[model samples]
Target chain A: MRDSCSRELTCIARSDPRIIILSGDIGNHMFDGFKAEFPDRFYNCGVAEANMISVAAGLALSGYRPFVYTFAAFDLTRCYEQVRIDVCFQNLPVVIIGLGGGLTYAPLGPTHYICEDISILRCLPNMTIVCPADQAEVMASLRSSLDHHGPMYIRINKKNEPCIYTGEPDFSLGRAQLIQDGNDVCIITTGVLLSEVIRAARILEERNISACVVHFHTIKPVDEIMLREVFSRFSVVVSVEEHTLPGGLGGMIAEWMIDNRIKSSDLIRIGTGDYFLTHCLSQKEARDHFGISADLIAGKIADGLNK
Target chain B: MALAAKISGNKYRSFVLMSDGECNEGTVWEAVLLAPVQKLGNLIFIVDNNGWQATGRCDDIMHLNPLADKFKTFGWNSFEVDGHNFEELLNIFHSIPVDSEKPTAIIAHTVKGKGVSFMEGDNNWHYRIPTADDVTRAKAELGLE
Candidate 1:
């Protein structure tokens, strides 16, 4: 995910000189290629995320589209106020890319975990949240972010993630892609959890319990039209995500369903409970422990549908 | 970049006003170092040195004594003035000090709640807005009657 984003940034800077890269002092070595290509456009703000956010906002207000990159812990939660007041409130064109989102840094403990970024950022107006599932989606989301005139957040994992899309499938903003079609239950997933949700869908397929899989890379605008259509048609809708339950993808869908008065037989939310995972574990282990892995998701969905 | 790019695009300089309580944030200092490194003379900042924070006095919460000295240490031209004085503010804003190599930080000494007799030097008014009667008494004190 980092490779795809950094390489894309270099290409972007060549065409658009107004696109500046501001780092929170972590990605200087990784962005060496970017620095070599466009030396004047890159800045390292030391380990100061709040300062980076304000500086990015200042740059954005001056007609430059600044991309601020840092780990999710410092990027979203630490500098939330600056992002809210300086970037979001002012409606600046700043792309905030948070690496190691969710449990990608699970080995580092809860301080590095980022289960609440989507929830917190979505609360601010003029903030668009995108959790790209793969390389292609990352590329598409980066390009689409340029077209947006306000603050956009792109959450990514730490290392090499397998590409889910065989080819770039008409990636557009505010539109969820329908990965598979079925009727028993609809699984709406976001971020890195798309891969697991896809696996869960396959398991349900083997059981002859068809499940519709919709992948939402953009979590804020959230393809509400398609979501409405899916919710009204499907009796059972299951929302999957790598975030906490309250204001994550599940809560978003619940809001839409409740507002539209679309009554489902069951709306199962597959995510973390209302507490932090306060232990050392790998990303997969954490997912399994939290009952958000593919097997657990499939089991929960199958059980709910069968009942 | 905001300085060079924006200053190039138009005919305006940026002025920022913030509170001394906000100095607890490390990012404020990071930005402080950048202003001079980038040589943004067009950017002028006014720090409201009210000496009070959310919980207690700023000095009790964090070590921010001699606020003007701290700005100078960050390579900025720092000065202190009566924040309530309109003329003093106008005089400082009128011209940048000669031989100034960096951005100017004006540390404006102020009270948390000024003008109102009851709320002055009190921390409660910092969190709570003035009630209707509070405003009435304040108006009388300021000779608005």
Candidate 2:
């Protein structure tokens, strides 16, 4: 995630010299390549997340698009007030890339968990929330974010996930990409969990359960028009995500369904269910434990259609 | 009225006592605080001792105990200066030899609404902006007439 962020920022810095990078005592070593490429554009703001956000706001006011990166928890929650008042509230165009969304840092304990960032960030006006699926999606999202105005929150995973698209797919702002086609079920996925959803769709396909996969990378101002189109195809819609069921992709999809009066036969949400996981585990293991794996998702779809 | 008179009369310095209502209400307190910091460089901030907010009071909303200590923490060289002493107020402000680096705070110990015939140490005035009659009475009491 940091690699992609640094790369995008470096590319943007080459063209737009006003681009600056601020890290909260981390990412300096990882961003060495960026520093080497654009020496004047990088600044490690130490452990001061609040000060970094404030400084980024100042830099943005002075016509610099400051990219602030840090661990998801400290980056989003620790300096939430600063992001809210200083950046989003004031409509500053600063890119805040929060690394390790969901339980990406599973073994690192609860402090590292980023389950709440989506909800908190989405609630802010003029703040664009993005959770790209994979490398291609990352680049596309980064490009879009750079070209975008106002504050943006890009939640990224820690490890390299599966490649969602072959190359740079056509990504539009607030538009969902329909990766597969099916009539029985429509699987809406966010973040890197799109990989799991795609895998689940293939598994469901073998069992004669036609499932469509819609990549909802952009959370806020979600592709409601695309959703209505997707919903018309499938009777049973299941929203899959790495985040908790509440205030995540599932909740957003549910809200959209409710608002549009699209009453699917069954709405199965695959995610963490009201409990933070304890005991060290990998991302896959954590998803499995929370009943959000490919097999579980496939089973839920089949069962929902069957019922 | 006292504040207006002091400002209009060309007084070199003045003080503003406030409650938490002024602080949390928005930039009114910030503007008030910055006015002194930006202005006289000699103004003193005295937050009245009777802790009160709106529904309950200061201790109810949030106990800011060692109140004087909190002001000191606000980049202001502050201590508990006296409340009712004309001589103490004069002496305290006179004795504060200015160090331009830090602003000075004198948390004067005073009742919330002191020297009032009816209302004294009351939280009602926190949000109640003075009316025409209230302004006239306040002006009369402060010798503005």
Candidate 3:
């Protein structure tokens, strides 16, 4: 997904002269094509994420579209003040590309794992959060970011993520993409976890339980129309994500359901617990440990249907 | 912004006015180290050296002495001037891009509160709000009676 983002950014910069890339001393080789082609547009702002964010805000204020790229853990948490004040406060057009979203860097330990990015960013005004499911979604989101008016946070996985879309599906900001149609249950997911959710849906289908799969690439400004439709149509709606349960997609859906008084369906949130994982594990192992793996999600959905 | 102008081939310049105490933040030095490498000649940073921070004197708190020399060491074209003097400020502003390939930094020596007898150089004014009588006296001190 990160590689796809770089490629798409380079493609976008070819036509948009206002496009500028700012990195926090990362992605040196990944952005080589962009730098070679548009030398003046790429800026490696050194190991200073805060300064990079502020500089991006300044560039945005001056009619330039600046994309600040760095690790998901450091990009938002490390320079949160800069994003809130310099970028979101003024509602600038700065696209913050957060690489290694969720537990993609699980082998690197908890410092690199970012499960709270969606939680923190969703509360800020003028801040839009988009967690693309795969390389296709990453490319689409990057393309959509060019026209997005306010500050946007694009959370992406590292690499070799399974492609959920065979072809480029019709993509837009703040709209959920329906991957499959079913009636018994709906599995709503965001980010790379969509692959796991799809697998779970297929598993449920084999058990004679029809499960719908919806991909919520955009967490904030959620697809309310889809939410209303899913909650009204399905008896059990499950939200699965690689992030923590609080203030993530699941939490956001829960709030939306309550505010709209949609009591027809029971929402089951599948994600990491409140605590961080102390043990070192691989991404797959970490997902299993957090009960967000395919098998566990399918089992949870089946149990919800039985109840 | 200066880098944006340079990349887009614009003649516009960008100025950032900061307080002396704000220099204590690590991000300030992070930007200080970067602007020179980018050769952002259109960028100018003005530091209002008021000699005091929130709790105590700036030097006593962080020891940012030789601040101008610090920017010079970091590859910026550094300058100093009396912040209160209009002519000095105008002269420094007119001489931007001192090296034509380096960012400019001006250390403007200033009092905490200028043009007022009671509030000048008083760090208490950083957070304290003046009473009505104090405001009247302040106005009188500034010859606004």
How accurate locally is residue A219 in candidate 1, as Cα lDDT from 0 to 100? Answer: 91
Residue B27, model 3: lDDT of 78
Per-model i-RMS: 10.9, 15.4, 12.6
Q: Model 3 Cα displacement at A97 (Å)? A: 0.4
Please identify model 2 stretches exceeding 4 Å from their true place. B1-145
**CAPRI accuracy category, model 3:** incorrect
* Best model number under DockQ: 1
Model 2, A49-101: lDDT tens per residue? Answer: 77789989999999998888888888888788999999999999998988888
CA lDDT of A58 in candidate 2? 99
In model 2 chain A, the worst 10-residue window by lDDT is A23-32
Instruction: Go through the candidates in order and give each one's C-alpha lDDT.
Output: 0.85, 0.75, 0.88
Predicted candidate 3 versus true structure: per-residue lDDT over B1-145, tens digit per residue? 8889989988888899998877866778889999988988888999999887655577765658899999999999899999999999999898785448788999999988788878998777875779999999989888889
The pairs that clash in candidate 2 are A25-A46, B51-B58, B52-B57, B52-B58, B53-B57, B113-B121
TM-score of each: 0.69, 0.67, 0.69
iRMSD, model 3, in Å: 12.6
lDDT of 2 by residue, B89-110 (tens): 7887777755343556676666
Compute the DockQ of candidate 3: 0.02
Candidates ranked, most accurate by DockQ first:
1, 3, 2
Task: State candidate 2's DockQ.
Answer: 0.01
Instruction: Indicate whether candidate 1 or candidate 3 has the larger DockQ.
Output: 1
User: Taking chain A by itself, what TM-score does each prediction score?
Assistant: 0.98, 0.95, 0.98
